[model samples]
Target: MAQFDEVFDWVVVGSGAGSMASALLMKQAGKSVVILEKAQWVGGTTCKSGGVMWIPANRFMNPGEDSLEQACRYLDAVVPDGPDSPGTSPARRRTYAVEAPKMLDFIVGQGVKMERGSTFWPDYYDELPGGVKTSRTVTALPFDKNELGKDWASKLRQGFLEVPVRLDDGMKLPFMKHSWKIKRIFLKIALKFVAGKLTGKHWVTAGAALQGRMLKAVLDRKAAEIRTGSPVSELIMDGDRSVGVITARDGRPWRVGARLGILINAGGFAMNQAMRDRYMPGTQAKWSNGIETDTGDMHIELAAKGAQLAQMDQMVGFQMSEAPGWDTDYVKPGTQSTTGKPHAIQVDQTGVRYMNEGGSYEEFCENMLVRNRTVPAIPSWAIMDQQYMDEYGVAGKGTAKKNMEKWLASGWMRRAETVEALAALIGVPPAALGGAVARWNGFVRSGRDEDFHRGERAYDNWLGDPFFKNGPNQCMGTIEKAPFYAIPIVPGDVGTYGGVVCDCDSRVLREDGRPIPGLYACGVTTASPMGRVYPGAGASVGPSMTFGWIAARHAAGLGNQFG
Candidate 1:
């Protein structure tokens, strides 16, 4: 290992998508780069995710499916200029719009095999301008972990799926549409696993695959080094210009100089309660599903050094609940049962519906905050009938349920024979819930959501149970079946979107709007380019890595117009 005092071309902080992308590019430019990770693992929360990159106009997109003009239109429509958000500006949009395809091509050319995401998977807002039904999202190919050797492979962050199958394989399974064919797929998977074990080949999927490929690319270059369990405590400034970082590793502080620049790719502040309370006010860290390593360490440390911030109230909102049996440190994202399915509705403490039930998780949580201003809507309840439990199942419980006694006994789920009784158990007014259900039933019968248009959009139906035998409105169903259930849901976020503001070149800006020389930032450590709205799946990582690449190129004295 080299001494910490040695000067490198670049010192990148945080070993997430942004960090590795920046480090790889800098190394490609014939510069030395070192990556620092706070956790014992690399990859950060990206490894726990689906590892899809939403790169519009990439090689994978079908002809005419995407264009810069349409993409700009979509950005304008989705993240419009307002008091809350400046919207995604044309300059930033153009930067990402052009660089995304190039970034995808560059990484793929470097040995990262990518597959187009689900053909049936629509953009989160498919009906919005420039939105496509498919091909904008690309996922990494499954990688054999054994290729990296056991010890180094085990250091990578593990995916959330405990199964051996990749996300594509899991999504392609016949269990949903063709249940009879599931046995064949299961048998094939079992045989493949057996064969792999016999051959000492261990395959990892999703985020692990993405990180493995990227790490392998870095290692192949032999010019980049990643140090885990190394937390960069402060930026070492030379006059007004950022020069280096002081990292605390193994109980000792060391000064590592960066001759070119330092890129802060540290993650969001979702796990930092004090930051959440201060910046986000009503939101709490306990409700966020973001990685625990994201404690606003970089944001706090850098803000004290005169870094300007923007969109501090924004977050990548989602619906989630406290993960059962896990420590009190985090919340598990809950998606299926509450929204997109029939026979269920999310309601405030007073049992009133506030928003369309089948909307995106981000929209759902945003509405939660809107209602929380004057009502107890932060921790609302997902009220559903036994039909929902039988058809879609409850949160934390899989689609197949052997018994509901344990869930009900644990008090995490409340069961009652009637809606009124359920409301009583959960402390909501009986009439309000009963009326809401009646209105919901009317909407179901008419194949129209008069109050809240749950099934109006293509994205809404995409999240619905396709096999559900309903009318044209797939997300609608009567909640008349007895033995209703209610589970508490809260405002949850995957990550925060606000931090130090950076220019299109990925240079961090000061309060005076001038670039801070030698200091660059990307990922959640900087305010996102998408502003207040998440465009689609992989929105976070797509911009994070793109800006990272941009930052690396710019710091190397390369032009801002990078391919």
Candidate 2:
């Protein structure tokens, strides 16, 4: 007896950072909005992230000497404009440079807690032109779940850590600290958890906190609705204009009409094998860390409806290693190679070192792709001495001896008494491995990596063992210990970078370079604003939320107006 079809002023396809931000902005503009999430939970892969937003000249942080001009200069040096990568367009760049700070201020004004993340977080490539040593990234402040009520708060995504910790607290303290400082920090975190439990004040941090606050705003506004377990299968069109979406719920199709526009923010094609095979070469969809639900349904359906695609061959990547307890089938989502630690060196299949081991995850995967063109660079081996293993642990796991025993017994890692023996076990030539180790040890003695300049950059030093301060080279340490180990690593990606092309206003474009009315996109559904390069921490989420905000205002016919 009830109507199977519904109508709203705006409908968002996904409930990630982009979709949530868009929904909130539209609600603030007095628009009736609804969100469609395929999964039962609200957060996507963003829940697994650090939830930092890289906004240059943001008012939330002390901008110091950073300005729109400096930000543009940095972007120009890193992200080049091209037909395939429209992220570097002057109009889009300027829009992002100016509107990003405003977007941040707007969200923070909506009861979303925030703090400066640049004091300790370094830029990914601070040595580059227009790059600063700090103060461009902001992170979500921890939230108490009691404020949202139990039933409503339960819908939020669970964090990856046992205790609530901010991005800078989680990233900097554990990986870079003295033993005493690390212990003290852990104790402080433990005490906070105890106090919270006693006070019935449950807290969540990182991406969960970020999405939770946005979700709270949506509910607080009371002008929006969220429908989970509703997978949008297609878009409904009136002539050439997108009017709504056709979603599948409870094994039935329902048409949800939008009066203004339908914004598609349902992530990228990272989990679609067919798209992966067609776009990314020498890489498979299984290697992506994106959520399994992110299979490009919106992208495929929209592309069929005449939306133009761009930057399909690029991804935000990392160097990932697998352990026995980990999800080897898909490689763990946050798996990272422990390359910057002392006495550890990454080598190609030929037992030859390819790049600076102390580089960022994006840099690591970029170099791996370049090497894959001519040689078998993926599944590279990370060789480390027992001293390094004992000090910094192996891969991205902890440094406990019990963990080491479990890894060794389960065959998750290969170990030997000497470098030559370890090389033999890992199918690397003994002589080649020996020579690489000798050269690395020589660099350690001189405190200089003439071959690759591993510890030359401040960003590199930030990732290195902070306790090991030997002149300017904290990343270098002699691998002369008795026992050695080798771990197999492969090129892993966080998410695909390619999607439909959009203009500065975030309107999806046709194949002939014209904007399609009433059809907009944000997040990974649109081509990245940073092109193929990641400028700094939270680059993906930052632009995703900003553009999402932009898309809603544009649909409301107030694109030119700002508060």
Candidate lDDT scores, in order, read: 0.79, 0.79
What is the lDDT, from 0 to 100, of the residue 151 in candidate 2?
A: 77
Q: What is the lDDT of residue 303 in candidate 2?
A: 91
TM-score for each candidate, following the candidate numbering? 0.94, 0.94
Pull out the clashing pairs in model 1.
none
TM-score of 1: 0.94
lDDT of 1 at 140: 82
Candidates in order: C-alpha RMSD to true structure: 2.6, 2.5
Clashes of each: 0, 0
The true-versus-predicted C-alpha distance at residue 98 of model 2, in Å, is: 0.9
lDDT, model 1, position 16: 81
Give Cα distance to truth, residue 461, candidate 2, Å.
1.0
Error of 2 at 85 (Å): 1.7
Query: How well does candidate 2 match the true structure in TM-score terms?
Result: 0.94
